[model samples]
Target chain A: MADAKPETKPKKTHQERMARKKQVIDERIAKATEERGVLILLKGNGKGKSSSAFGTMARCVGHGQKAAVIQFIKGRTETGEFKLFKDHPQIDWHVMGHGFTWETQDKTQDIAAAEKAWAQAEQLLQDDSLDMLVFDEMAYMFKYRYLELEPVLKALQNRPKNQHVIITGRVMPEGLLEIADTISDIRDERHAFRLGVKAQAGIEF
Target chain B: MADAKPETKPKKTHQERMARKKQVIDERIAKATEERGVLILLKGNGKGKSSSAFGTMARCVGHGQKAAVIQFIKGRTETGEFKLFKDHPQIDWHVMGHGFTWETQDKTQDIAAAEKAWAQAEQLLQDDSLDMLVFDEMAYMFKYRYLELEPVLKALQNRPKNQHVIITGRVMPEGLLEIADTISDIRDERHAFRLGVKAQAGIEF
Candidate 1:
């Protein structure tokens, strides 16, 4: 917490150690008192970037919170996540991507797709009834400059104070990270693909 | 693919650029043709470690895949995740922790709880009917040495070859990370808790 006591005493016993740690932790817990929808950015090359985004959205359903998602850069019906949340309640799910940029080389087409996705994102940002909004792989759209940064920033800044928005992708746009309330840059010591393990159903996709 | 041509050509047109990138990507995609269940590890001090794990389990429910989970460290029925997956089919869920280490100072009682949880984990490991097995916060048990390493390793080694396992927590055990097929060390540059924002109902739990 903001007023946590500094560890100056020797914690020789387990009881003492716990007491010291608890004193600090309790204060930290007390310091966190705000209750509002947060903007979470899951950015990195690691897996679970989108999975984490989708996972939180899934939690919203069980907790009786309304949520919506606008995926950019890539969308596919074959994905396990898409199949699961396609018809679920409280999920205004939209997979607006054609494919990964590596697969779709046409920049103009990709830009058009991104713009369409952004339109939906803007709409979601404006809707105050929603509780969570996910822009899966929206970073690619920003990184590629398919859409201008001003509108995206404006939407994020002007969205309903109670609506949590999650942006996920490999490269964290420096500007976006600056404004996000929480930024998780997921990384890995090693990757499965590097060692010849292929992406599997219900695991990677 | 294994035999993909390196990008040596200078692409002047968008069509040419797309073709070049697509050729390499197609080959890379072709190279990954194997199908097997993987061991995924989500570990770090950052948020979303458990969210990523539970989210995937939720995905399993909708995708017709059987998934089981054993949550260690802290298990409370009031969690949003518990409310979401309590009645879902194809899920074998078990919450076997009284509380976190800081809350429960009794090592013996904690060990007993971990053993009970491990009993369920061991059972799931041997079942072979499950597609995914999640050891939610199991790393804490391992790090604390509440559960022995030998039996756990043996179970993992002896489990069904195609079964996927997910372990999530901070400070991943060295041994568990070694055997895990995939590892995501989620890191947040700035935690919301540090910023005095409390964990929200749907977002944190």
Candidate 2:
């Protein structure tokens, strides 16, 4: 005992702690047994919310699964994602907004566009053939009162069993939050645009 | 003026507030004049860090730009991303780890693997031909002391001016944070895995 090195004790303790952590993680992994569709919400004033959704859509397409992208409040058709995925065989891409709310300035037109978009979304929600759907910037509809939250919530709840839904925007309503299987709130820690860097084509859009 | 209803006053006030917001946003947009590649850091204990990276990769490919991805600490070859992006013409994908640290448990081996990965990254950093590079799960190396921060920072600083770098993981080092032009902190508000929902193949992998 007297010959034992001081570092050995700490090393052993560290191993024990790691072992405990492993056990907990293993247990949690084992506990997760149910299999079904999930509603994932990506919100906050961050850079990657839409990017994350697109990435997952790519993954779904990679798996040979059918997917659809409904872009609200982003009317531009020249975005890199739109250009790439618009004609993809397994993807249905739609740009449904006139533009940003401030740019539109016409509440009636914005509401009409949102309603038309939601009408398509409502139909898509019932589509079991589609493995995934990306409701890009859908939260703004709720935040701006463009669409009723109840019907959207009900449609989400009643969607096909194995179809995953990904919603991305800057704000999330409480009703959507309650039913979300996963919620990722991306915080904006820093942005290049704030530092006098122009929003480049492939990076920002 | 005396005939104006209470709601009309609020409506005009709202428009004035929106006008001010639009001016601020326009001024900020105009102020950003510099154009260059960005170093984006995606960190925090949340999902979609790698997803966001891969999404941007797709965007880059959409624009006909070359990109590379170096995955650290994820050893699985059957991931959805690997299966989809590995064969892409514009993408150079490399997976360089035995497994998670807990699963490996060999400090010497992990360190060696990290070094090998960094060597490739260092070379890629100098390649102006590559438009973008993703060092996935790289922050763990710094947190675990498998790699030093100084050399990485220096390489990033000296990289091709038009080559963007994206680093993703749970914890970001101070050095990396300092150099990052854009940083997104994805917060885990809720997770399906914690609620007895199994990690699905396309969604979780």
Clashes of 2: 0
* Consecutive 10-residue window with the lowest summed lDDT within model 1 chain B: B54-63
The CA lDDT of each predicted structure is 0.83, 0.91
Each candidate's TM vs. the true structure? Answer: 0.92, 0.93
Error at B7, model 2, angstroms: 10
Q: What is the C-alpha lDDT profile of model 2 across B1-205, one tens digit per residue?
A: 9987677444564456667778888998999999889999999998899999999988888888899999988988778788888998989999998787667766788899999999999999999999999999999999999999999999999999999999999999998998899999999999999889998877887
Model 1: how far residue B193 lies from native, Å: 1.3
Q: Write the per-residue lDDT of candidate 1 for residues B1-205, one digit (tens) a residue.
A: 9899988977578777678888987677678776666778898878889889877776665678999888887768777777777777777778899887667766788899999999989999988789999898988887888988878988998999778898888887778878877899898687778888997888887
Off by over 4 Å in 2: A1-10, A13-21, B1-20
Off by over 4 Å in 1: A1-16, B1-11
TM-score of 1: 0.92
